[model samples]
Target: MTNEFVLEAITREFPESVLLSSEPYGMLTVEIKKDDIKKVIHYLKDSSLEINFLTDICGIHYPEHPAQEIGVVYHLHNMMTNFRIRLKAFMTREDTEIDSLTDLYAGANWMERETFDFYGIKFKGHPDLRPILNMEDLGYHPMLKEYKLEDGTRTDKNDAMFGR
Candidate 1:
């Protein structure tokens, strides 16, 4: 149930798949190849580790790191031991595909769709993959870092009222 126990378990079981491992805020976080994410999660859910709860699935954007421009983070919880762990898999903008976890966790459907809606990450093998939050015609992932932070064309209001 300790962080070291979970870290050692995952690294020992998936030596090559684990790209990086760290304990932040006393939680075990492991970064692995995007291709091996499904396999790794399957093992963690079904193995003795008993990390059975899929707490959340979210996306991250790192525009500065072209090689890893997009990332998916999985948060898992073990009810028996009250233990938790974080798994991350990142890929480039050119290849933004990762296996769907819906088969393993039904709750993944909505979470995956939300991630896709905002981050444009395609979840392969998802039964229904489409925008769950944004409009289908939005045409772009809003969470990506390339977009402007504010609307430069807004000039209707007074500059002093808007602090411009």
Candidate 2:
């Protein structure tokens, strides 16, 4: 139930799938190879660790890192012991698709959709992959770093009033 124990179990189970690992803020965070993410998560769920809760799934865009420009982060929790862990997988911009976890965790359906809606990271095998919070015609992933943080053309509001 300890972080070290869980980390050791995962490393032992999949030696090559783990790219990097760390314990930040006392939480075990592991960066896994993109292709093996689904397999790694499957092991964590079905193994003795009993880490069964799927807390969240989200996407990240690191524009500066060409080889690993897009990433997916998964947060899992073990309600029995209140232990938690995080897993991450990254890929290049050209390939933003990753295996869907819906087959493993039913709750992943919406999370994967939301990640796709905001980050354009497709979830392969997702039963219904579409925008959950955004309009279908928006045509772009708003959360990517390439988008501007603010509308520079806006003239209705004065930055002086906001102390900007």
Give per-residue CA lDDT, model 2, range 79-101, as digits (tens): 99999999999999999999999
- Candidate 2, superposed: residue stretches over 4 Å from native: 155-164
lDDT of 1 by residue, 1-164 (tens): 89888888888888899999888998999999999999999999999989999999999999899999999999999999999999999999999999999999999999999999999999999999999989999999899889877677977756688577
Q: Model 1 — which ten-residue stretch has the worst lDDT?
A: 155-164
Worst 10 residues of 2 by lDDT: 147-156
> What's the distance in Å from true for residue 6, model 1?
1.1
Q: In angstroms, give how far residue 19 of model 1 lies from its true place.
A: 0.8
Model 1, backbone clash pairs (residues 3+ apart or across chains), number: 0
Per-prediction TM-score: 0.93, 0.94
Error of 2 at 109 (Å): 0.5
